[model samples]
Structures are given as structure tokens and as C-alpha cells.
Target: MEDDVRDDALDLLAEVLVWRLAGDRWRAVERALDGLAAAGGDTDAFREVLHDLELAGPARAVRIEDVAVLPVPEPVRERINQLVHTLEGPGRAEDDPE
Candidate 1:
């Protein structure tokens, strides 16, 4: 991908990734869930897994091209595509999970 396109993708991803996600705000949400388990909510068993975002330090700009890096294998390429779609559903992620 071209530099411009990659930059655009990165911008969009950043916007989406950080949406409604800040440590202070999420801490309150977790606090609100304090009684979830006691109330017998099934999700209480995995409340942490329900989080869509994680608190982090300073952001770093990362371009899609830097991630894709043309020489990647076909499996990695397919995995990338799958991962993108998964993110669309507010889905699971791992650091370069296969």
C-alpha cells in the first residue's frame, strides 16, 4: 500500500481503537460491575474478557504497510484479513495471534 493509504488506515484504526477507552473511565465501569458476580450474571465469570480496549501509555503511530510488510507469507496475509474482519465485530485479539 502507498504511504498515504497506510497513514489513512492507521489514523482510522487509532480512532476506532481508542474510542470510549481511557483508564479512568473504564475503572469506573469495572467498579459498576462490582456486584455482577454476586448477582449471578453469567458474564461476571469473564468480565475482563468483555473489555474492548485496554489502558495504555503514550500512543505510537504504526502504519498498515509497516505491519503488512509485503514479504509476509500467504498464511499471515490471510490471518491479517481474518483479523481485520474480526475487529469489525469488536472481536478477540492477541499480539500477532495466529
Candidate 2:
């Protein structure tokens, strides 16, 4: 039951990410993230799910300016990249040792 709930939450977050990215709305993304967090989901976990969605190729990537009208910081981008790597799992990356 816990696993099911977690998956459902993550799936919702992924959908929200795709929606926000499609509409080029960073504020919407942030609001969705906050709502998820308030509902007992981890914000960082949702961010990771967003990265995974991007990696899975269903979500379109947008320029920082397209989303926020300003440059997104590199650290945040790196965090997203790291989330993708983490969610993609071991042995999924060609360079992964496992």
C-alpha cells in the first residue's frame, strides 16, 4: 500500500512536470511541487521524478528562458541531471559499472 501510494504520487508529479514544461511555466511547476510537498510528498523526490520523466523522453525540454524568462542556476540543473541518473537506476547508464 505504501509503495502504491509512492508510485501514484511520483506519477502525479511526473505528469505535473510534463504539463509545466509543455506550457513553459516554472511558477506552475513550483506551485505544483509545493502542493505535493504539502500533501506529504517530498519536494526533492518530486524533482527527481521530473528528471526521470525528462529522461524517459515523454516530456519536452525547454530553454531556461522559455520556462522562467531568466537563466536557471547551474546547481539546480545539475541537481536535475543527478536525479535523472539516480532514477534511471544502476546499469542503465552505459558507463555504469553494474
The local distance difference test score of each candidate is 0.35, 0.42
Q: Give the range of the ten consecutive residues with the poorest summed lDDT in model 1.
A: 49-58
Q: Model 2, range 57-94, lDDT digits (tens) per residue?
A: 32365555565443333433443344334334544434
Off by over 4 Å in 1: 20-95
RMSD of 1: 15.1
Cα-based RMSD of candidate 2: 9.7
Candidate 2 accuracy as TM-score: 0.31
lDDT of 1 at 23: 42
Measured with C-alpha atoms, the lDDT of residue 86 in candidate 2 is: 38
Error of 2 at 26 (Å): 1.9
